[model samples]
Target: MVNFDDKRNFYRMLLNSEVKVTIIDDEINSEFVATCRDLSATGMAIEMSHPLEMGTRVKAKIESANASVQALDVKGKVVRIEEEATDLYLVGIAIDDMD
Candidate 1:
């Protein structure tokens, strides 16, 4: 059986994301505390305080922060978003491979 929706869906992507991701921008910017919903080599799902818009570039420090998936600090940009209730958003960030 051929499924059109499944073939074109990006939601089916597999990720090994870690929780407890630390969002760090410049000194003038306050850090955003988030959790990893899923993770890939290039990106991760971060449930953040704000619904970060797509294309917004930011830096992140991959720490268990308090959880178990303690990743190294990384750089990346927002590529996608998922709305979950009010005042909360599921953001998919594509971490920049370079520092």
Candidate 2:
């Protein structure tokens, strides 16, 4: 048996924390509670109850405080979506801006 490593620009860290995901569009503006599955400097993977369309711009905020920071806010775009289970979707977001 052989194992192959994934080729990625940035390393991803596994995180199972709850974060707020907001999608603001001309037609609709809504927010959803999502779980952050993995996080990297450039992007993150989140699991949400609803599926967001590809190319959708979103805002993600981490409210919980860690040893280093109090909170974090970032602007991202939806890059990919995968159905994890019934009524659940895993979304891949590319970070555009960070604050």
Candidate 3:
């Protein structure tokens, strides 16, 4: 038998944060504010306003409820999008250094 683990990082420290998402496209742009439920070096799961479909790419800022920084700016692709209740979206994004 083999152990099957899905998470890339389970032991890494996760901080609860509220982040802002800027979805940029050639013709359209949208802004969203969401609570970051979990975070890692590679990715984060955010509770957002609208459900970003899987593979949707966007720019994000990891701003906490307390402060803000320049290092939080990054591009991400939505790997999974989950909807809870109505008008709320749980989106899993894969962070990338390359823009």
Candidate 4:
């Protein structure tokens, strides 16, 4: 028997603070707003009103006024999605590139 587990290269920080997020999908030529749930060096989890399909390539810009961090603009792919409630979803994005 063989076992393999998904591992992360960076540490994740619990960030409950509200931050502005702009998600852009070039394939659909659409963009939307979302809120950040948590952040890490490699990725971040976000709460979005609209559900994005898994594997969607996106460009995102995250801006925060919190004293601990600075703004981030990156391109990533949607890796996972979980429904938290009606019309709300939790999205996991894997950071691919940074600007």
Per-prediction TM-score: 0.62, 0.87, 0.72, 0.74
**lDDT by residue for model 3 over 1-99, one digit each (tens)?**
112364565433455676778776524777877888876678778886678767878787874344553447778888998788698888888888633
Tens digits of lDDT, candidate 4, 1-99:
112343666667776555444456554557667777877778878887878889887777767577798777888888999999999899998988988
Q: Write the per-residue lDDT of candidate 1 for residues 1-99, one digit (tens) a residue.
A: 224455433343343344444334445654655666665567767776678757777776655545666556677888999888787788888877644
Stretches of candidate 4 above 4 Å error?
A: 1-7, 17-28, 66-70
> In order, what lDDT does every prediction score?
0.64, 0.86, 0.72, 0.75
Ranking by TM-score: 2, 4, 3, 1
Candidate 2 deviates by what RMSD? 3.0
lDDT of 2 by residue, 1-99 (tens): 112375777778888888898896635768888999988899999998889889999999988666776677999999999998998899999998998
53 Cα displacement, candidate 4 (Å)? 0.7
Where's the lowest-lDDT run of ten residues in candidate 2?
1-10
Cα lDDT of model 4 overall? 0.75
| Greater-lDDT candidate between 1 and 3 | 3
Q: What is the lDDT of residue 69 in candidate 3?
A: 33
Top lDDT prediction, candidate number: 2
- With a 3 Å backbone cut-off (N, CA, C), the pairs that clash in candidate 2 are none
Candidate 1 to truth, TM: 0.62
Kindly report which residue stretches of model 1 are placed more than 4 angstroms away from their true locations once superposed.
1-27, 64-71
TM-score of 3: 0.72
